[model samples]
Target: MLDRGTTSDDDDPPLQKWLARRGKMSALSLAELESCKNYTFQLGRGPQRCSDVPSGLTNSATLLKAEKNSPTKEGLLASAFFASPGDGKGKVRFLTFLHQLGDKKAVVKWDTAVTRGMLYIQLPEDPLHECSRDSLVELLDVAEEFSSRAIVFFSKKRNDMKQLVRTFKFIGFDILPPSCDWIPTSQEYFFMSYEFG
Candidate 1:
């Protein structure tokens, strides 16, 4: 049997559950992409690192990760500096987890959901301090070990909960209107998970 697409039934559920915890979702909806300017205007009206950008999806194929411990910021998102699905809605899910003061810290959750015929590895978690160079190397190694797979990073910095909400809403997720307790700086909160890439 030819194994098509990224394989990781073990990791996706926990990741999905973690994402669900971060945001409130009720069914799926598609976005109404009115115009190019309009789309670009609301791309990322949230946190700014002065370097983060979106990386549009290209079949979810091979993804490249930036150097560890390096001050440089590049290749961070599928279409942005965060780890999220770029454009469209359909099956998109919003991760709206809130981070507590101390207990809520960043974590990594990577799994491959590749094309129907090929393989690709996606790091669907926070790239915080926990993800050391060695850990990332190990993750890449795991991907290489699979021969047909490529490991990718979904950084938390550019892909905070707020970004998720906005991105999801843009893609037509059943996101509730932004409230004070859930808006403004709420994106800065930590929605830490126990898992690591």
Candidate 2:
């Protein structure tokens, strides 16, 4: 029989223990995002550069120009730049997970407002890759503590749309109706949201 440790620290709640056994998720600073060599998002067009702004995700001209020109003031000028309405009341954070060996596994751009939140996943180059379920759950757990709901948007034309939809639904997100007034109407994309009680 397996020996379950008896120490109080070892007796972490089921969710905490499960999360601890998987991997660590933490916020990534802007400098870290810029330094991450493995960061890439495969948009059907091709693998986009790390500095490229995710389509339909931001309207910040500063972020756009910063991402376009390398070694520019992107780090300084865009550090505090708010990209979405969500940023008006709160801050934007980049979260990532690293494996036991410190290899980056996933990255998420998170924007939080007083009551609303959003997530933008940076897809890996590997077509078969997906963020680990544990990591996503941990992210949701964190989001739940702050926002009443979390939202995600996906382009209809994405190659992984089917898989992404399934994954989000598996994690408790529901497809938002086309008439949902919380999000801006866009013909090119669909939205999903997870409401916390």
Candidate 3:
């Protein structure tokens, strides 16, 4: 298990905003909250079929299916898949998670493609809270949804990487060597993909 002492971080803009905004939430009830900051779904092949399948992105068809299946959802919609290299070769993986920002909700589709030397992992704006145990589980669910053979995470900032790695490790993910060069970054970013056992 990971040590979740406090949701406090100096480099986290969400945490910073959390500290600056809102009143005491001690009396706040999660029961009143209709949705979660991070919500997950299963699409395409799950981790169990990773070896027999591949990795890709969550397509519109799947999103439409989800919309039709459930009519009353308003939060980050995560669609995961296993995709082969953009060239029909190489390897790719996928998973998704959500971050609370405000009352506003949006659907973020990670239509990322891994190229010879580049991997595009696009996400929505920053989150509104620190990564907690619940959020970590959501992340794993998303990973398994993609049927990823292995999970990977990347962050420009070492601190963010440390925090992310801690959370993932607590949830049973291990660090793997980089398959490609990770660009040096001043801002924080995270990329994690898990392999199916």
Candidate 4:
């Protein structure tokens, strides 16, 4: 594990100050956050698979099938795959947890996808007490409803990488280098595909 005691030459700006006006903290600044001793996800590939499999984002058809078969109300709505909260139109949306590489703690979002495998915009975690462990359980419950397998978290932050290495030892995923346009500040971003052994 990385040491938290190292002091930087100067006190870096608070994360809030560096975030985009809409609320996204700079993905590049994860390294700075690491200096503060907080744990966050790293960018990189996940575990490996038995046979070769594509590492890119899962398609809409697959996502829809996953949603329809999901056991939980939340998961059935495809909230786990989207980046925005609640379905537009005010209906309760899905909850998502994003582990930005090099930052501490995962960010929870209410989100939607712009494309099949990409998010349009990821909303910030709710400051109110609504998003506690119980909320996470509720979110997973929906996913469990349809998904036959465990939901895997993919991260690029070093800490997240460690967590993945620790938690998913039995599974296989591929950690691939990100594509050209996806410039993440972390050393690498990870791609996790669910694997069952």
Task: Give the candidate number with the greatest TM-score.
Answer: 2
**Model 3 TM-score relative to the real fold:** 0.35
lDDT of each: 0.28, 0.41, 0.32, 0.29
lDDT of 2 by residue, 53-115 (tens): 754321111121112122222211123332322443222333333321113544333222221
Shift of residue 157 alpha carbon in model 4, Å: 3.7
> What C-alpha lDDT, on a 0 to 100 scale, does residue 58 get in candidate 1?
14
Where does the lowest 10-residue lDDT sum fall in candidate 4?
59-68
Better of 3 and 4 by lDDT: 3
What are the runs in model 1 whose C-alpha is more than 4 Å off? 1-107, 115-119, 125-127, 149-197
Ranking of predictions according to TM-score:
2, 3, 4, 1
- Candidate 3 C-alpha lDDT tens digits along 1-197: 22111212212232222212211222333332112122123223223335655324322112111111222221121222222324333332222333332233433333232222222334334431443444334443433323233334344445455666676677665554444233212234455544444
User: What's the TM-score of every candidate structure?
Assistant: 0.23, 0.43, 0.35, 0.24
The digit string of per-residue lDDT tens for model 1 on 69-174 reads 2232223223222222242211212111111122235433344332222223334454334433333344433323223323232334664556554533443334
TM-score of 2: 0.43
Range of the 10 consecutive residues with the lowest summed lDDT in candidate 1: 34-43
Query: Which 10-residue span in candidate 3 carries the lowest summed lDDT?
Result: 60-69
